[model samples]
Target: MPRPYLLFTQHGWADTNQSMMALATALTAKDEAQIMAPCLDYAMTWLRIAPLIDQVETLATATLAQQPELPLRIVGHSMGGLIWLEVLNRHPDWWDRVDFLVLVASPVGGADLGRILDPLKVGLGVAADLGKDRRPLAGRIAAAINTLTIAGDIDGGSDGTITVESTRVPNAQFVYLPGLSHAAMRCHPQVIEHIQDFWAGKRLSEPLIPHPLVNRLRQIPGMTDAHLRDFARSTPWHTFTDGTSIHLWRSPFGIDHVFLASAQGDCLYAGYVGWLHGEDLRRSLDALRGEPELLEKPIL
Candidate 1:
């Protein structure tokens, strides 16, 4: 019998190996495949594209060294996606080693949040690394391999931290999860199923899966229902599209309550909407990205 392919799962910035381990574990349950979850150097200080490219190539080379004969498959979340792109670019020969690639909530078009807070040691090459207009590696990534781009949209169309726009690229199959967040895209069962089917050569259907809201607002760590009431009729509201920005001011009590919506008036995400820690909170938000002074934050 032919050997099963090698599946490598890479975690996003400030994320642990376990971030991709859940999906890895699920893929290996039947003992028909093997998944390798590698933890990258997710430091805020080392976000420059060149240095990061070197780091990823090293990891990929070593992994391939172990079982060079097996065909390769990859799943990268957020920064992990970019890392793999660079790996393929730096070592063109590695492309021969890869069979399929999946990018989940990766800012291949550039991270809007990175552009906003680049001063706080978030220097992932903000100059050329954070916008859709300057996707130099798109051609490299779009070549030869069938790349799958999956995103979560809880706010009009965002995964709380990444906009669906930020995660897309030309010549790639895009799957959007209307009810999932950037982080949740990593572990959501629907997301796992998507990866599983795509890896096994199954045809991805049209009108991708839809995730439903589950009163997840009150699930935020430091928020309560009282905080959500701040969005009542008289309250000021703001709106934006994917890869855009929205500023919310604290209501004197040192807290900002936010809600996310689509242009046609549809809700996306709900939770404790606070600043400094991250995006997504007691309110709904869409077209949002990133965290402030937060090494690690949750997506809406």
Candidate 2:
């Protein structure tokens, strides 16, 4: 059977496939829906120019071409979400194909971090193209699609990396969660519930009951606080790849990106950030032909 919804994760520079796959694992349980998180190529960051949109459209077309019946829904974390928006802006026809767009901690407005660094130096060239006066991809897509931007309030105001205001687009619905870090929103079950409820026809404005574990994770030491700090310090860089690199991030069940990597590894990681069950992480690592260190250490 074809997938009805595509859930994707667009990792910032510091993330990896392992982290996103771990998120996909946590979102699943005994009777949960099936989800796949494909890692995207690094070029998405720099390919922010016009061609990047074409890259995402091609991916959506390919996913649906394999199974034409499946509807498309795009979910991108960080810049990947913006990539999805860029795809839709160029291909308005795909608007009907997309059921929902969930962006996790993405800077729909120009990111403050990007602004802080001179636009010329940011390797992805996104800063260069997405100039102060230039309209953002998020702003462009918000006018065309059913969009939702979710920001984490772990740092009181901002989601560690993106500010609350930056995640806002003109017409799209916006959500702000307290305590959840920018990266942790992926693993937060409440986020999954929000997505599922939206899939079940809930309005974008519907209120959701908070997850119980949301509070407990903060009480535990060395975990929540550590990630919070990491989220703040996390930055993006370039990734070096030869030839045409097709990075298919699995946020929307169908949409993705294709890019040409520069000599420098100047791209973002296609990963997810969330609180995952240790057992699930173990299983996912096994599935990915990798081993997780969490499984080896004794839980004190």
- For all candidates in order, the CA lDDT equals 0.59, 0.50
Where does candidate 2 stray beyond 4 Å? 1-9, 22-36, 42-55, 119-140, 204-300
After best superposition, candidate 2 residue 231: deviation in angstroms? 24
Candidate 2 TM-score to native? 0.56
Error of 1 at 129 (Å): 4.3
lDDT of 1 by residue, 1-300 (tens): 335777888876777878698877886566445677876555632455566657667766787888778888888888778777877776778787787889888877556565445424344353335432223465456556777889887766457776565565655667777888788888789988887777667767432222112122223433221212233322334433332223233566555544444344443332232354344442333322323322133323
In model 1, how many backbone clashes occur?
A: 16
Candidate 2 residue 83 Cα shift, in angstroms, is 1.1
lDDT of 2 by residue, 141-224 (tens): 666667777778766557787665456555567677888877787567777777656556667663322121221221222111
- Residue 281, model 2: lDDT of 32
TM-score of each: 0.62, 0.56
List the RMSD of every prediction in angstroms.
11.8, 20.8
Off by over 4 Å in 1: 42-50, 119-136, 205-300
